[model samples]
Target: MTEKSFAADLKLYDVEHLLLAETGEPPVSARDAEARDRVWEMAVRSNPALFDGPVVACGGVEWEGPRTLRLFWARVTYRHYALRRVPGAVALPSLFVNVLQPDTDGRVLAVRMSPSTAAPGRWQLPGGSVEPPEVGAVLDEATLAGQAARELVEELGVEAADEDLRLWAVTRGENGSIGLTYRAPARAEATLHAGLESARAADRARGREPELDAIALLADAAELSGLQGAHADYLEQVVRRFTAAG
Candidate 1:
């Protein structure tokens, strides 16, 4: 057996945050396109509390406080006409965050990968998948925000407090199966703590110290897209939306 690259098992799970719940691709028929438009329109007009499976949240969940806690609700989107079973579709809404920080000039907190990642050497915003409490995943909405700040510290060897971070806004995208999204902002530098054990280990194995080569603010939007793979595109789209709206 062979080991998969970090990028391999690194499941992008875009549907976890964007418009994705499962994975399947077929040529969109004219009828499919028309139906998709209708569904997409319904999704756009509908609140985030419509889709809730035992596993994923479809919409109508109430979020409370600064943490964005989405309490469960009903009136879920029970119709996924595309698949017999929803792949990444969750009964409950999952949580995730987009990290924003200042650059060396205190402008933007863009980042470069350590080349070990699938998007190695590309510029991207720091983020990850979120597993809600029901699934027993470590990261939730609030936790993801904290992780954003923590990732700043560990990846850059800086210390940033959760309070100082700013909440941008949550946006939703669906990949035909799953549906959800979140975006936030924060400062550039902070006091780093070796909180991410696996990330630190990966660095150590490579003979580099933790946060040795983590995220850094990019010069601007143009410099951010130079990265390779899905990560680069992911960062570009996410950051653009985040900054544009802000």
Candidate 2:
């Protein structure tokens, strides 16, 4: 059969398209099989017969497109033994965090950032991917207190002694590809800096301090629930343990 040229941007949608790249199933699992079936059904939702063979998905596929389109191929392969989407050439590194905080008023000090960030209009702890400059003494130091302290001063405009920060927890990727190390104030703070100018131009952008939006004292898990996404989940787990210890 002659290969038909597809459109530049063919769109595909299915349950399989929603597969989380980091979810608990194998790269291709039974869940993926189900997802693929759902996506196939969705494809046939229009024509009702594309499930029999390899149905071109996503207009011949663009290697430079979004991650979702590429995942359809894996789902189809695992479930229908077919091809629904084409692969893209993009490889984005999964993110790891370096959330830091201060202790005050029986409440874990948390900072909110400008929602204009990549996560968009959400609150997260102050931290990010570790820098190459932080590689020296911190490689063995899981908490990397020294680096966290420096980040506090540089990013958050807070002065924290290395000895004044404590490790709260270490969240690692399932396969241990990376770890999100958390640290918090060992004592009350004397001053705080937003690190707006230097931090923005240096790393994130210009004057992009999320912590500048609004900060609140979280009383308990119920109160902290006001936060969204993984940050909320992480704070619940970490702060609950903190409360139990006190």
Lowest summed lDDT over 10 consecutive residues: which window, candidate 2?
A: 11-20
lDDT of each: 0.42, 0.41
How far is 167's C-alpha from truth in model 1 (Å)? 1.5
Write candidate 1's Cα lDDT for 1-246 as tens digits: 111111222222322221122312233456555565566556535544333232223333333333333423222223333222234323333333446554334345555565444234555555533333333243334554575666555565445667665554444433311222333333324422233344677669888644334444454456554544334434554555544544
lDDT value for candidate 2?
0.41
Misplaced by over 4 Å in model 1 are: 1-95, 104-106, 115-122, 131-142, 173-202, 205-216, 225-234, 237-246
How does each model score on TM-score?
Answer: 0.43, 0.47
Model 1 Cα RMSD, 1 decimal: 14.3
Worst 10 residues of 1 by lDDT: 1-10
